[model samples]
Target chain A: MWKALLYKEWIKTRWYLLLALLVTLGFAGYALLKLHRAVALMGAGHIWEVMVTRQAVFIDQMQYVPLLAGLALAAVQYLPEMHRKCLKLTLHLPVPALATLGVMLAFGVAVLAVLFGLGIALLAAGARPVLAPELVGNILHAALPWYLAGVAGYLLGAWTILEPTWKRRILCLLMSVLLLRLFFLAPVPRAYGGFLAVLALLSLCAASLSWLSVVRFMAGRQD
Target chain B: MTRFAKLFFWFLVLVLLLWQLPWAVNYLLVQSRNTPFTLYSEVLDDFVMIRHTSDKEVEYRDRAGNEYTRRAFDSLLPLFYARQLTADGRFPDSVAGRPVTLREAQIASFIFRSAPKDLNRPAPGLHFLLESMSGRVDLAMPSDAFRLTGRGIEFIDMAANRIDTAKSGRFTRMLLRKGCRFPVRELSGNPSARKEYDEGYLLLDADGGLFHLKMMQGRPYVRAVELPEGLRLRHLFLTEFRSRRTLAFLTDESHRLHVLTMPGYGIRRVEGVTFDPERESMTIVGTLLDWTVCVDGASAERYYAVSADDFSLLDTLSYPLSERRIPGLSFTSSSDRYVKPRFR
Candidate 1:
């Protein structure tokens, strides 16, 4: 039953997941290629010095790509289910309704984790050879908050999309905006070091919020 | 599941309130206060203040409330207004019974400013050790940058993209020979090429010992500075001013500001002043005779006039500032680099 449910989610999100992976990887690769151009023009040492003294992360172009991908995934995966009322049929399957919802969210999170993880690994691998450990660590740390925002954006988008009524959906959207603002309040690089753990926990905790919308749907919540 | 969802919802609401409520109130209600620009006048032996009246009229007055004409105000602060005094032919032969020339005053004049925001912000773990005796009239940035590690200093050559292990070992050995502990606690230097000269860096070692390191003739010149027993230094500012009278300005754990005199390397405490480099901003405008030090505090802007020769407190004045605002939670502050929830 869980396999069937997993298959259903994969079927729903596979094309979108592939697109997300490509877009994210494209941005990550482009950032590295830009870094390579910089290294060639201004020596690797100049790049390292700038990163150390000025805190310049060459991958700023990739900052919002993960976030857009996450939001797009949620829109692609849940908007159709909500519009077509296919979620109601999926809820009536042999599996427990809440468990089904949990599995769907889990699958989305897993796919995002893999995609985001690949992006980060590529960044680290590309940066390590040409830069010192400290500079590489700085670039990675600077990107952590943005990627976390992507995951949170996806979870929060799911919550809003699954909400059973228009009035509550508006409230959910407002709350999500506030929550997502936490991940982007930093303008300084590595400003989110100590707070990253708590932010990631909160992003994962946001998964539970989707279940509330599901329960509201089951209770026939409406405007 | 219902209980958890309810709790989560309330938690979210609480976080929003904590982050936004005070911000909105402060944004709507806060009015920042402006204090009169005040400077100590050595000739008048009083503080000269340029104040803006409610009607927006500018008035210059001494602490005794005696109004002064713009020309008179310039005469009172002759050292600060040297060019104006010379041009007016009112340049005095002496101030406070001490004969001082315009050239002398100009050479002795210096301004040093340190703000908590600069100290508390993020710093890249790299430093340029400019050559102190480059044999050139003007200082220039070094070709390599250095980072202090647990064991020793590592210098990275910019063009070569490799560590200069030989030069690094030489400096590291010099520092170690001077009894500097492996990892330094804090280091300060004016590394810009625009400076008049380089004094390298003032480093506080792990064991709280202070050492001055500079490069002269492409070699390390390390000097172990003797701190007064039990004097725990907290912060340091390398002052490479034109005056060349002081090497650096420092604050200790007790928040007392000290001046590190040049050549001799002795420290003199600027008495009767407490400045926390983590919270307040301080500016010292100095002439040969006196230094007018202003420390901007939470509730007041305090001014201290100190004798430049000895750093003895000559006079002190403070004005109460009323900055009305709603206080609440903030994540980032003007005085710090980290983004963590804080209440003001």
Candidate 2:
């Protein structure tokens, strides 16, 4: 039953996921290309010095790419279900309604993890050649918060999209914006530190928010 | 599941309210404080202030409610405004009954500033050790950087992105021979070519020992600085000032400031001054006569006049800040570079 639900989500989001993968990887590659071009122009020593002294990450261009990918993925996966009123039927399946929504949210979260993980790996592998381990660690630490925001963006995007009433959807969006603002409050590298784990947990708890929308949808709430 | 979801949703709503409501109120109602720039004057024996008046004019005054003209102010702080006084042909031949010159005054003067945010931020573990005695007029940055590990120091060539084992071993041996424990707790250095010269780094080791490490002609110059008994230092600032009279400024666990003087590395406690480098911002204007040290705190800004020779407290002044703040929940702070839930 879980496999069937997973297959349904995959079939729905497969094409969009492909595009997201490419766009995210393309942005990551472009950032790496710029880093290497800097190294080629002014020796690797210059890059390392800047990264050390000035807190230059060299991947700031890709900061918002993951966020957009997550938001878009949520829309592609859930908007169609709502437009066609297929969520009603999906909830009426043999599985419990909460379990069904849980599977859907889990699928979105998993795919986002894979996508963001690949982007981070690509950055680290590309940066390892011309940078020391410390510099590479600095770059990764700076990017960690942005990637976490992508996960939160997907979950909150689903919560907003699955909300039954238009007025309530706006409220959910306002809350999400404030909550996401927490992820970007500090610009310094490694500023999140241990707070990142707390943020990740809160982001996962946001998965339950989509269930609230599903319950409202089942109760016949409307705009 | 529905009940849990509803509870979680309300929790998030409460968090946002606590975070945003106070911020919005403070933004709407709070006015920024315009504190005067205060400095202690040896000639006046009082704190002098420079402030902007409501009529869009600059006012210079002493703490005793005495205002002075701009030229009079320049004459009062002759050391601070020496260049201007010299250019105007009104420079004093001697100050404080000692023979002085514009060159001596300029070389003896330096400004040192440290903020809480600078000390509270994350440190990039790698450090550059420039050649201190390369026989060249201008110092150049080294091709490699070093990191302190659990075992010893490791130097990595930046271009090759690999460890230079031979060079690393040589420095590691010297540091070990100098009795520096592994994994430095805190290290400070000024690593720019624009400075007069390099003084390398001041390292606090695991055993609460202080060591001075620098590179001279591609070799290591490590000195184990002896600390006074039970003097556990919490922070260090390596000052490469033009006069070269002092090597670094240190703060101990009791928040008392200490100065490490040059030629002998003698650690002298600056009397009657307490500066917590983690919470307050401090600025010091030094001359051959005295230093005007300003410690800006959350509630008040305190000024101390200390003798440059012995760092003994001469006088003190303070101005209390009347800040109208509505603090509830804050994730970011002006004093730190971290994002964490803090309530004040």
Candidate 3:
């Protein structure tokens, strides 16, 4: 059921997804030009030259700066629809709320992953020989936090607009900010417990909002 | 809070935590080094003499099992040894009516603890010269680098002027081993004959009294000797002062800048130059190689020192090849990159 909902979300937003990709590619072009000039300035023997590669895929991945672009798109589109009752029409169908929410989140995450994969491929191509072994570990560690912030920010923005009461919206906003503060203070960059907690909450909200959207849609249909 | 709110909250925290991991690692490293070290005095001498003692048959171990080799001044210049003044004005081996020669001719020294603080931790030993003075201070003043001659444990003038030291003034009297000690008339034609001659460090008063130091212990010309047992190594501190032209930093790249003193080697917290608020500029007068620089009051930084008359760089030759700036520059002097220290 979640698969169907995930597909449904994709069908509605696929064009936006394409737009996001193009925007990323354009950003990559700009980054590539900058890298070329920087490399030229550093000359052939500069240590930072490894960061700039000529491979097409590598250039393409520069468009992907973790999840910043993804969240921006989602915030402008998904949150408003659910908060304003547009999601009700879809949730009324025979779908497990949790499954549907999971698919939607995965769909978002997968799109983000594609963006990231392209960048890693390019960076790998650039670092042909003298790649530091620790780079992989650091990049892996970095992804956890990037994904969390991107998805969480989008969801929060959507939920705030959907909620009827101003207090709940304010509370949600404050909570997100508070959580961000605590994370910075924590010892580990990637705390598994924290990730799980965030995932559970985001999934739960998606379910609740889907139900609300479905109920409102049905009421409109009867009228 | 609703499910969406919870997710948003947690995600925010995770992102912030990732940014903070690197900071924790740095703090841990500094704390560890502090365990075996503490700041005692702001000590800096003109030159640090070093001699390697690893080849010796018997090596002393500190409480820490760290294996450290010893170092000492290569110079064999006779050092002045002063005796504390009694009512009779005499101490140690002395001729009647003559100054007491309490200090012996020293060849090597270790200022810090020669002994390991712990048995398990093997510490590397530094062979800078220093020993106890019987109420009188010791001065290891080598006339020039090549000659390696000095007066050991000469005397201490407690009221040292942080301002002017090159000129002569009445320093408190401690018995100076007066003898046929020659003012080094000629340095070795051997290039860096002076540099190769490791001079002991000294703390001097405005009146030329000396105190607070480290020197190697040995005969005036001996090549090696037994490393001292459990010598106390003091932590060198970094100091700040204003300068007109560039001040030479430590030549030992293997070592870092630990202290900068005004008119001496270390930097005390004291500001070395003063300025009038109305002038809106500053200049430091030099009794030695440095010129008074134009600056904003007292500052310790790297500036392109231009000659006020011609605006040409005054001390460009002293920088070593491939060196541009000193890290955490506290005090600097004319460089040694091209020209070696005249005193060295």
lDDT of each: 0.87, 0.91, 0.33
Residue lDDT tens for model 1, A68-163: 888898998899899999999999998898888889889888899999999999999987767766677778888888899999999999999999
Of candidates 3 and 1, the better by TM-score: 1
Write the residue-wise lDDT of candidate 3 on A1-223 in tens digits.
6566766677767777777666654554454455445545653223121321110111324322444565565565566455566566554568754455446656765775676555445444443332222222223333344444545555544444444455655765665554433222212212233344645355335434433333333455321
Best by TM-score: 2
TM-score of chain B of each: 0.95, 0.98, 0.18
Off by over 4 Å in 1: A44-46, B84-93
Count of clashing residue pairs in every prediction? 0, 0, 91
Decide which is better by DockQ, 1 or 2: 2
lDDT, candidate 1, B4-49, per-residue tens: 8778888988878877998998878886665788888988888899
- Model 3 complex DockQ against the native: 0.01
DockQ of all predictions against the true structure, Cα-based: 0.47, 0.86, 0.01
DockQ of 1: 0.47
Off by over 4 Å in 3: A25-29, A44-67, A127-148, A177-223, B1-344
TM-score of 2: 0.98
lDDT of 2 by residue, B47-161 (tens): 8999988898999999988999999999888888899999999889888787789998998899999999898988788889999999999988889988999878899998888
